[model samples]
Target: MTDVHRAIGTHGFERLLHHLVQLRASQINRCAYCIKMHTQEARRDGETPERLDRLIVWEQVDDFSEREKAALAWTEALTVLDGKADLGALRARLRAHFTDQEIGVLTSIVAMINLWNRIQVSRH
Candidate 1:
């Protein structure tokens, strides 16, 4: 219900992509509430059970596309980085698959979810 959540709803990303970002951010932040909430929302939006089950272990799963893999990597790196690291390869992969604006929006979406996860986890 926050502005960030409202922006996500308006962003025009595919349902699967949106949920995938949410799931990745939730996992990074260790938010069980968000994990459960997004998983259920993802299912309702038609994400397959197999994919959802494999999300936490996405690197070990072969179900994800190359672009998705790159995006996931980018998501984690961005969330956890402490300083300037060479993200050139990941950036290239993302650029090849996503428009510049998509990359920007996706980054913000992950950041926003992570922010929410912190709030939700700390308060409860």
Candidate 2:
């Protein structure tokens, strides 16, 4: 899981996107430690206060691009573990902005973060 996390940041999409993905998943999982850690990491990497503040309400804002919004939709759906989510529609949205390889990387990032969030949350 750690290795996959490293790879996700190092490849496919930008580091900012990776941070957003991880942070969003962590937010959904209610991992306070992760939320703090990822928020700081993202800010250190130049993510704006506005973006971080608006992250939870990203769908209703214009601060993010279509590509980012697509990624966020995927992240939210996966983190929420919604069995009824229309995955086909999600994939189509993702495909509009990302390649298959990118989508795979994004998926891996979400999974790794969710695992980490679970571990972190379980400790408390």
Candidate 3:
């Protein structure tokens, strides 16, 4: 984990946003390994264990902030590719809190984590 952290370093710690996105995406992908690993990591990074436990039910939980909810929603929409992503709506909501560049980075992080979750779970 340390080596992976060192390798991904700056880009990896760019924001808490990416990590949260990865956690949510992993849940959507149903990757138990990633869910366990990232949830622990997220807790180490100061995310509350209670919040982490409720992450899979984020939509139904009021513990997450508005920005986090929006990110989670976007992650799910994009991951499921349900063709129902209201990009304009999501963008408008996100733009209120995040820079365009931040949104781009988050989107990339979600996509990458989703791919990782699939590859990891497939190996089992």
Candidate achieving the largest lDDT: 2
TM-score against truth, every candidate: 0.89, 0.95, 0.83
Q: What TM-score does candidate 3 get on C-alpha atoms?
A: 0.83
Query: Number of backbone collisions per candidate, in order?
Result: 0, 0, 0
Residues 1-124 of candidate 2: C-alpha lDDT, one tens digit per residue: 7776667767647989889988999988999999999999999999999999999999999999999999999999998877899999999999999999999999998888899999999998
Regarding lDDT, does 1 or 3 come out ahead? 1
Cα lDDT tens digits, model 3, 8-124, are: 445543445566888889888889899888887887778887887788898897998888888888888778886666888987887887777767766766767877888998987
Which should have the higher TM-score, number 1 or number 3?
Answer: 1
Give the per-residue lDDT of model 1 (tens digit) for 1-124. 4876777667686778878988988988899899999999999999999998888788998989987887888888887885775688779989988999888878887788888898889977
Every candidate's lDDT: 0.84, 0.91, 0.77
Q: Rank the candidates by lDDT, best first.
A: 2, 1, 3
Question: Residue 26: error of model 1 in Å?
Answer: 0.6
TM-score, structure 1 vs. true: 0.89
Model 3 clash tally, residue pairs = 0
Q: Which pairs in model 1 have colliding backbones?
A: none
